[model samples]
Target: MNQASRDVIRPIRADEWPKAKELRLLALKDPVAPIAFLQTYEQAAAEPDSFWREQARESARGTRVRQFVAEGLEEIWSGTVAVLIEDAGSDDAFGGAVLQRQAHIVGVFVRPEYRGSGVIDELFEAAVGWAWSVEEVARVRLYVHEDNARAESFYRRYGFMRSGETVPMKGDPSKEEREMVLDNPQLVSDIS
Candidate 1:
């Protein structure tokens, strides 16, 4: 679907490693980057070409993890999200989650201009749809910074509720991150 004449959704190809890396750098440059991303541009850019190549290959076919990107008419990626399959005992970037059959949503980003538009919804539809489509996944979840009210509100609109669970930050152990779980729509759909 085109929004204001912009074709906003597309999957990043395995051959598009360089583009992925570039977009990541742009995301890190944003003012909210410090909280939005776990890694800095300096760390990512410092990686050799091999790292980009491997990232592309993994996201291309890894059932455990997948990346989706939204592009504008200019073919510039405006947003992205990484979905990772986490079984009951899987450990993610945030550490271990004991929720036996769930997926962790991470690496979410949207360009300033694309905020408020359906661009985010489309990206989410793509990610959450993939999560539910997985036969082994029972639910999906994410962690947001307590200080990020905007993100918390967005998650609420998306059917994610605070799980009342908190995990300390991996980098800064003194800080805490809160968990939010996506309501399992299957329960409602199955009833009807």
Candidate 2:
């Protein structure tokens, strides 16, 4: 079947914790996992069931975080991306101050067979759409590892531009993760 016919992009429900955990573990095992994520398969895989439950619940509706999944044939998830809202001047998870109210996209992963099949684009559309829907969100942003050219290029194509902010990669001080931003042009035009 074609990509569109086989896939559905939607927000993950609180009860879908098992599916969420499974997809994350699979993503961490992919060949490019090292550059794509901050956690290792061992670490994520070792987490308790309660941890997964909490994680899923936190990303459900009514929270500041949301996880969107692309479920392909047979209801299996083919890709996932998560967004976390950050308030301006508040310290981020990495100890850096957020410069503005924005949604931070993270944990992007797509199954190998689904790569380049527009799965990522669909996931991004859902994620960015949610980000823009927030009342105080001025834009959306994400960080790409300096060496992750494939990911960086994808984000660029999605309208995200380098924001000139860099953060040291966790556990890899020599490398950097550059911040990219996509301003809410609709909001900008409205304000003008």
Candidate 3:
């Protein structure tokens, strides 16, 4: 059987904070973490247990955010992705002003061993599926660092198109991140 078939993709639970924290720390240690994530290993490692618990709790049940994980047969997490709903006229997680009702994909990570095993695709399927379920979401978007060619390529293959928007990488004005978007197919069909 394929790896995707052996694993289950589902939203995280509030009680799984420890696993979530572990996976997040591992992701931060990845070589691409510098460009893949906004936070550093030192910063995340310094946070207390309460912080991780709160993060897991919010992601588990918060109306504005949801985190999904790919769990293997042994209950091991293979990958994770999160979507945060952004309301029009409200501030986004990046401290930017939001111009539309959208879902911002973030915290994407897959265990190195699981790369190319279809786990990432399953994770995105779950994340984007949940994003589309939100009535207020008109589109789903994510930012890929300009230097992260692998991620950018994957996003393109997964049907995200560059929206011609670029934002300066936080704390590194020399680098930039490109915005990619996938409009809601249901909404698109309705318009057509």
Candidate 4:
């Protein structure tokens, strides 16, 4: 069977900070990291262990944010995605005003060896599914760098459409990131 088929997709536990930090550092070293992520490897690596521990702890709580990981046999982590709940009238991670209650997907990363193995699909499914479970979350969204075609294509295929919104890329105002959104399917069905 394929790795993806055998992998378990679930949220990271508070005690899994070490593993989370390792995976995040690895992601930062990826070739497309420059465009795929806002943080640099050097910056992330410089963070104290407390940072990762708190991050994992908060994500595990699943109250405001959650980080899901794809785990295979022997507890090997293959990928991760984080969802941040944004309340209406609150500022988002990018300092923009959130117009509605929503879930913003971020820090998406899958190991190179697991790409196209269906791991990404599972991760996204879990993230989006959890987002919809939140009360009053009207939609889900993410920002993709204009030059990250691969990520943009995958987001499009996963039912996210361009929202015609753009934001200056963090640390690089000369470049922009495009916003893509996916309305809550449950809400859509209800309206229909």
Clashes of each: 1, 0, 0, 0
Q: Candidate 3 regions off by >4 Å?
A: none
lDDT of 4 by residue, 1-192 (tens): 788999999999999999999999999999999998989999999999999999999999999999999999989999999999999999987888999999999999999999999999999999999999999999999999999999999999999999999999988899999999999988889999
lDDT of 1 at 13: 78
85-105: candidate 1 lDDT, tens digit per residue = 877776666556565778889
Best by lDDT: 4
Residue 60 in model 3: shift from native, Å? 1.6
In candidate 4, clashing pairs total 0
Candidate-wise lDDT, in order = 0.81, 0.91, 0.93, 0.96
The lDDT of model 4 is 0.96
Predicted structure 3, TM vs. truth? 0.97
lDDT of 3 by residue, 1-192 (tens): 888889999999999999999999999999999999999999999999999999899988858899999999999999999999999999986778999899999999999999999998999998999999998689999999999999999999999999998999998989999999999999999999
TM-score of each: 0.89, 0.96, 0.97, 0.97
Tell me which residue pairs clash in candidate 3. none
Clashing pairs for model 4 are none
Candidate 4 ranges beyond 4 A from true positions:
none
TM-score of 1: 0.89
Q: Give all candidate RMSDs, comma-separated.
A: 2.2, 1.2, 0.9, 0.9
Off by over 4 Å in 2: none
